[model samples]
Target: MNSFFHDENVALYRKLIAENESNPSRDEDRHAMLLTLLAEETAKAKQLPRLPDAW
Candidate 1:
């Protein structure tokens, strides 16, 4: 679950980077939204506790 969230956050950052590269002047509002999303995903990843198992 944590890995999933981490992957998603990385994907989002990549998307934002692509968009910014295409449109050199990205709006401040869009940047803020991306930052907020990244923060939320990071928090969620941190909150997830380690799981114990043997297979």
Candidate 2:
């Protein structure tokens, strides 16, 4: 289970994605949303307990 994602956030992203899918104009919206989600995941990962193995 992903602790970082809440109900509200999921709903909001779903709405955004649905909107972009319904209308194929202005391709930046999907890219921007994806980047935002990635950044959010990075932020959440930073808060986790550190381990020996790393990049």
lDDT of 2 by residue, 1-55 (tens): 2434543455566677667667757488565876587567666756766545554
Clashing pairs in 2: none
Model 2 stretches astray by more than 4 angstroms: 1-26
The alpha-carbon deviation from the true structure for residue 2 of candidate 1, after best TM-score superposition, in angstroms, is 5.4
Question: What is candidate 1's local distance difference test score?
Answer: 0.73
Candidate 2: residue 36 lDDT (0-100): 85
- Candidate 2, residue 38: how far the Cα is off, in Å: 1.1
At residue 48, candidate 2 shows an lDDT of 62
User: lDDT per model, in order?
Assistant: 0.73, 0.61
Q: For residues 1-55, what per-residue lDDT tens digits would candidate 1 score against the true structure? A: 6766686786877688568657867887877777777777777777777565553
Q: Count the backbone clashes (under 3 Å) in each candidate.
A: 0, 0
